[model samples]
Target: MTALPLTEAARGATPTSSRVAAVTRLHLARRINVLVVPLIITAVVFVVTIVIQVAIQRATAGGSTAADYAAGARLNPAIAWAQTGYFVALGVSTVASTFPLAASLGTTRRDFALGTTLAHLLTSLYLTAVFTALLGLELLTDHWFGGFYVFDVGLLGAGDPATFAATIAVSSLLCLSIGSVFGAAWLRFGPRGPLAISLATVLVLAVVLLVAVPSFDALTTAFRPWWLVVGAAALIVLSVGGTFAFLRRASVR
Candidate 1:
């Protein structure tokens, strides 16, 4: 088959909006496993945790078989943290793989970055919706599955349902953005760059922890919804902006 001329291929190229959408679609498609498998595992872990907790409660009841073991049951919602790692991997893999491929296919860096950001946003929103719905169902069922507290624990269960969902969504976006920033660092400066950045961040954090240990309680107390939202937005802006800046000069290797 004869290849089309460069000019002809350019003229027949996908429209700008379609190109961006395609990038987003492709990224999402490639990440479906990462997006889904973790959640399923998380749900299984939650159920298992509930079972273990119930068994312990029953054993400790001292021959009282009719004791209400489900009462006062609580389980940490740490399984949700799996979503954080998933997003981080998603960000890194998308940049490591898709960025170069898209660039080679004549897609501009701007469109690629925009599409990636859009994909992250959509993924975060979808996860948030699922989480919120599950939480609502848990509450409606009076903490289903032996009254285990999977979604209702710590700050996640502190506020009203709307506040909880908003917090989750914002935090998810922030996590995705931070992951993308790390991925971009790797893309721009290779493996050494990310290692250096990680070391610097750890050093800075250690210093802060040592110097400000006494004020940690105050900081924790002041972490209200408004402040969290503001901080998450700021981090998202910084991460996305940094990724874009890096990609503008990034070479496909």
Candidate 2:
């Protein structure tokens, strides 16, 4: 007897289900380039910075008194941590760059936006893990580097661990929110989009800085306690909301 044609079963395959699977695969594939590579680069940068800062601290306090070493070492992590904004920017931009690729691949706008946002969230988690590991190492090694706000073995019993934990928790959320919006915008709108957003952010920040600094003549600081948190929250909310709105407004394939 003649065998049934394979084409008949193939023709009966569900298109919608296949399309969803295809979209998922495509999202994952795009994510590797947009998220993983950038996160790796950020991690590498963090390692290099840590090494350099540690070396600098060692050189400065290689033969100094314990108190002197502690003081000197403490400054390095603080400085290095400040410079971490560069890695954050890189991670965000990497995720953002994926938008154009998604669009090029004929993925729906919503999927593209959501993918970009998810990539940022993943990268933020990665960074948070790295920071935590670094902090733990510092504490374990009795490294008295003040810049990073690490636990001092001697002070571990005396100091407030809750503060450190809370700080990390807050910082991680801030990074994720900021990175998500920045990266998504870059991906969706190319270089111009990032430029516009960056410029606007800078302008607003500059104004705040100028306004706040000059007003500190009364024993008060202009740095709002919740400024970073609130700003991050706004960015995250706007990014998600705007992305969805944009997708809805646009005609997707």
Candidate 3:
């Protein structure tokens, strides 16, 4: 039999749910750029970090005091921070590229938004699992190449596997949510809009910081893991809501 058009096929399927799944599968097919690229970057950075640590250790191998070794073994968690940029790019690209295609395929804005949200969440969880496994391996292998501290740094966990994984997972969601908002803004308002939104965000953050500086210590103390959880949830809700609202009115340009 001749194949039906995507819109007709979607109508004949399970309706909303299947449409969302179809949109999700469309994005998932491009998982290499969305997921693997960032992972490769993270892995490369991790390897470089270990190499640098090993070089430092080797330089002081002979007659190196315990304090020297300890100092040399210190690892910065900057590589993990770099991974967030990839996630942000992924979010922006999804909107810039996939939105138009989905619209062309007769996908409803609600289904597209839902599908993108689901894709990002699943991607975030998958990356979290991978990072967690890497951390475990790093720990088990005593830092994966001559006692390096790439994944065992204080910023990540200092040694606690659970804390490291939880931190990565939460931060990944926040980055993904923020990026999605940025993308949606761009999609709805065009180029200037996202820039304007970004500037406004910076201004608001600056104002908040200026107002809270006097109570910085107290604020930091009050900001606990539960607060992070709440904040992440709020961001995810707002980002997804904003995306849906924007795309609902957005034209395929």
User: Each prediction's Cα lDDT score?
Assistant: 0.74, 0.51, 0.76
Please give, for residues 89-184, the per-residue lDDT of candidate 3 as tens digits. 888777768888887777777888888888787778888888888788988886675677776777676768788888788777777777777888
lDDT of 2 by residue, 1-253 (tens): 1111134354255343443344344434555653465456546655665677567666766566666655643443432354246545644643445445545554555554555455445545554565456556766665534333333322222123444444444455455456555565554565676688779979999998888776677535446546656765776677567555544443322
How much is 67 displaced in model 2, in angstroms? 2.9
**Model 2, which residues run further than 4 Å from truth?**
1-64, 78-96, 100-107, 144-191, 218-227, 239-253
Residue pairs with backbone overlap in model 1: none
Candidate order (lDDT): 3, 1, 2
- RMSD (CA, angstroms), candidate 2: 8.0
lDDT of 1 by residue, 1-253 (tens): 1111224366357566776787788777765454776578668877787787678766776644433443334335565675677777777777767787777666778878988899889888987888888788878887774656777655575425987788788888887788887887888888876787789879988998998788989888876758767867987998899889888877788
Local error of candidate 2 at residue 106 (angstroms): 5.8
Residue 230 alpha-carbon offset, candidate 1, angstroms: 2.1
Task: Give the 10-residue window scoring lowest on summed lDDT in candidate 3.
Answer: 1-10
> Which regions of candidate 1 fall more than 4 Å away from where they truly are?
1-15, 62-75, 214-223
